[model samples]
Target chain A: MTVTTTRLRGVEAAPEADTVPLGRRRRWREDAVEAVLFAAGFVSILTTGAIVVVLGKDALHFFRNPDVSLVDFLTGTVWQPQLGKFGLLPLLNATLMVSGIAMVVALPIGLSIAVYLSEYATPAVRNRLKPTLEILAGVPTVIYGYFALTFVTPILRWALGARTVDIYNVLSAGLVVGILVIPLVASMSEDALQAVPRALREAAYGLGATRLETSLQVVVPSALSGIAAAFMLAMSRAIGETMVVAIAAGAGPRLTANPLRSAETMTGYISRISGGDLSYNSVDYDSIFAIGLALFVITLGLNILSGRIVRRFREVYE
Target chain B: MTALAPGSIGLATSDAARQVARRHRVGRAGLAVFQLSTIVGIVVLGALLYNIANEAAGLVAYEHKTDPAAVLPGGRDLAALSAPELAAVLTANLSPGEVATLEREAPLAERSQAELRRLVDERVLETHAAAAWNLTDSVLDRPAIEATVAERHPDADLRLTSWLSPAFVTAPQSGDAEYAGIRTAILGSLWVIVITMAVAVPVGVAAGIYLEEYADHTRWLNRAIQTNISNLAGVPSIIYGMLGLAVFVRALEPLSSGGAFGAADPTTANGRTILSAGLTMALLILPLIIINAQEAIRAVPSSLREASFGLGATRWQTIRHHVLPGALPGILTGTILAMSRAIGETAPLIVVGMSTYITFDPSSPFDKFTTLPGQIYQWTARPQPEFHHIAAAASVVLLVLLVALNASAIYGRNRAQVRY
Candidate 1:
């Protein structure tokens, strides 16, 4: 395609265009383009950084009131927005609870599929399943929200027994979100699995090791950090998920880890407050930013940690 | 095709036996599972399509069913009872089959009196005759008694159609299922996404250029920027919304957040406007764009750069003339994915204050916006049976749009790959 395009554009024929040893004018034009592009890129960072600062200032502004204590905001389990208090743990608890549940469910199924695609499956199986797996990514989170509400919730209630209005329960959302996040773990793990030298797989096979055992004992162990990194990435996504938690788990912030109880994640709280009427400095409203700041810190931590681990893991590689 | 034949059409069995088969016994069990499950999977796919498409077709039974005993000897006028009112009449006596069907279709966690009240509200019941009934929505609750009672009541309404009304999609969201539409929310989402991409792309790509071409990697500030970028990508998008809440909303609260727009105090109003929303979304996607663009630039063969260098080309000259063009595809892919995520994202928008009942399109970047998913969340939470059903329909639309966007991105990536 490059060959065809170069020919069609007559880039090869412009010999004199290349011979002029890029003059001052040419250099200036290039520098100008580079400068503009660089500014454009820096602007996104500026925009994002600016947003962080904005949210921080507003969230912190809520603390300026004598009534809001930093102690109450951090350790308080009861998140009563109607009162002037700013305790955020209940929502944070909900966020972490669901994320933890999703990770547990996503890790094994995703890793199995990753192994199946990368090591266990024949080429024909691998070729078809990989793209189908990725389709899970394309399906919108809102659609997954519906599927979780409609499909998974009822089945869960039946299994868990009656009175389970545990129907719009956290378990269902986390379980479905886990399923939806399968590709993230599976695809990245597949890449990491494939990155392991083929010679290792061949060596194990030569020793009469079964494919399953080889994948379990050798490939996964070698790429543990990469797999863990992918899991963390998926965890970040599940934690940030909004519609599913909103539609299925509900919008009432609470500090309980009980899957059966209706509770709000940080995302759900933000979605709820945003949709409703809120006076900006009305402490309940500013709590949305408080939650947002917390979410940002958590996710940012996860991403950097993954990068650091990946870096260290890569260093261990050739 | 494979299922119809005992042997798959393309298998080379005899040649395989002649060449390498020590034992000729076929592992036909595995083949059988493959062929059998392929058909099963297809059937399931077809069933899902049939169910979803049937609902989406918007087919409705216009005739409202009424109890002759309750309606009196002459029977009730379907036109007198709006959609919710008609549903209320049947609510007390919904057949077990009908109840089960409704339960299957309207599965929103709670089944208490409050939920029941949501559908039977004066506002909703008064307009029951005006509601639309799709395949899943009251498939059994046919509007059977459409005959007008003009002699008895001059204020009676008309029951005109049976197929899903065209108005079902164009109308803004309403408590009545018949008038429910995602148009406003969909438009709001489009505007927000457009503004988001507008702010995010140019800035993200420019940052990529600075890092790739201009900045010295050895500089501590540059390294800090790089580390933070990778870090920023990991940061939960809600945090950006928090950031927006702090800076954009608080700093400009008086102008954007409060006042007639539903605020008790101007000082408390966080300026969670569309501009702030856009900035927040830009922050969420920027890291991806920068990283992807940088990699795309790095992918350009060093030989081209060296050739230009040999000819006395400036560092910037080699990139502008050759590298930028080569990296376009990678940049496009990242930008599209980031944009798609921004479109679907509900977390930060919630943090930055998207509304649920926005009747008008966001008039400016500073206007408060209601996104598709945000509205979908609101719809899902509504107590009415019809709104719950409509949520599925709207989700289908969102899914189709997302798929189309992602598909185009995939096509773009392939084209770019081919270009290189």
Candidate 2:
């Protein structure tokens, strides 16, 4: 009661010039600014809503269409969407094949690069080399697509006889995509390795462990979850990449697992088909959304799972 | 240390010490391998740049079907003449019926000066010298190329041509490789980027402010929002293209097509316009901008806020006058980087209906458009080898634009560093 009375007395004693019109206007302006800021924050939520609703509604149409059977979409091998064979196996397998190849190529090299950056290089070398790798990362995917088509594929064919490799094989695309993701994997894993407390490395070193041993056994295992997250994220990137596969991985919807042959990924399918003039609400048009829904769910699940693992394991070291 | 003693080992040769030395060697080898892998990455980056640059510059020998002396007065450069002057030349050269047919195909009066110039080059010149050497062949196998040119066409005029000349920048897309330019694509990209910036910058900055400054940590809703934004960042760009097709192209066609505003062209009422493409790109880069802006805003010192509060400044006043100015440079840096990504992006725009062969400049948001990357993609898809050389030249242009954008971002960051 005494505090309230003192505040009231202070306000009463304040000059009218300070307390009346300007104070009210200032308060009003503050509220307005906050409201505007709040609206800005709300737009992101609105975008999420739009994505969900749009994908959901169109995907429902695709499933409900008489021509498409959920059974075929899940289990069948062929994927000629225009012919009413909406089997997702071909597309999914191709996506997995490409991602698998990308992982095989990128994992060792990217980790090695990260290991060198974190445990081996001097500060100056690290600073100079990190941005050089970033230049690779920042080059547009379309350019990478061209590089795969014009350079990598010919090199592959020349290395291993031309007959074994089609002009637009998944091998070249996957390899180029791997090169693209190397920087991502390297940088993320580097951050994870760096986050390993210095004391742990010193403890291993004091026990006469070599730098490689400390980095591999002590530092790396401590940062294993982050490394795994990097792998998952890179795989997600590989699966969703469009231009490289569209340009180099060929447009054929082959269900084969051979990376030497051309196959269409989910993203490649969407890019190729969407470029065509499909009438609205057509099966082919609606099918793109269904495929997109699948991509969204897979990537979303991988990201969330990786994020959870990273968070759950982070506490152990922190 | 005693564990490694020679006497502690059962062998006279001290097996323990030898084992330690072997392990050390293994470790050294492992480090060498890691260093080699890093070198591999650098080498790959170097090779990519080399390959692109190899294709960007070269020698070319062209044989003109019609002599310039026959077409123009005093054998002047085709580019030296204005649109009207070129049109007059065409009128004097072609028969009256042929002139009428040419004008009907693309009204001469409606065409831009650049378009008129291209028309004269295409029709009057009848240039059919199709075989071209790439940068690699032209330089490394110069003797071979010269031999082929000399043997094949003794009358052919030989001159080294830069694929990326001033004419290349100003010319629009064309069927002929020699005449194709990136002017339309550049303008389209600029238009799309302008809309992207308009939509993304303000919203992204505001979202960052709210998240960093006003969000209540204890609220589950705010936490959910935070999680959603991060997840959105990891979402692949092509999926955003799908979202754009569903929402912008089909669902919100009225607004995206400008139909609701009564500003849309009746014949081109389709929602696949620059506006839809820009909004889609804006969505794709929104999370990136938001995350970067949040980091920038969060980096602002807390003491400034405290000092403002101590000075009787309200939270809004403190943020408006102090926090924003402090964060502006950082925000600008992030925004520019996001813009760079949006500019180079091709997949989402293709899915959202960027034409592969738009020859005219996009005058409004509702006009159809193509980007530099789209043009490159189109050119690469062609069967002709000459198209690949031009595509390489186009990639060079795109890379230069990216570098310029990144340089500005770096400059902004440096300025921010000085201010802080």
Task: Tell me the TM-score of each prediction against the true structure.
Answer: 0.74, 0.90
Candidate 1, DockQ score (0 to 1): 0.27
Error of 1 at A101 (Å): 1.5
Which residue runs of candidate 2 sit more than 4 Å off their true CA positions? A1-26, A315-318, B1-13, B61-121, B149-158, B418-420
What value does the lDDT take at residue B258 in candidate 1? 47
lDDT of 1 at A107: 83
A296: Cα error in model 2, Å: 0.3
Error of 2 at B367 (Å): 0.7
How many Å off is the CA of A47 in candidate 1? Answer: 4.7
Give one digit per residue, the lDDT tens place, for model 1 in A113-231.
77766765789877777656655666667767766776667678888885855656888888777777777888898899889998888888787555555777888899888998998
lDDT of 1 at B370: 77
Can you write out model 2's per-residue Cα lDDT over B141-260, one digit (the tens) per residue? 988888888998765656566788778998888888888999999999999999999999888888888888998968987787789888888888988888888888877888888888
lDDT of 1 by residue, B98-119 (tens): 6567668564234434343333
Worst 10 residues of 1 chain A by lDDT: A20-29
Interface RMSD of 1: 5.0
For candidate 2, the docking band is medium
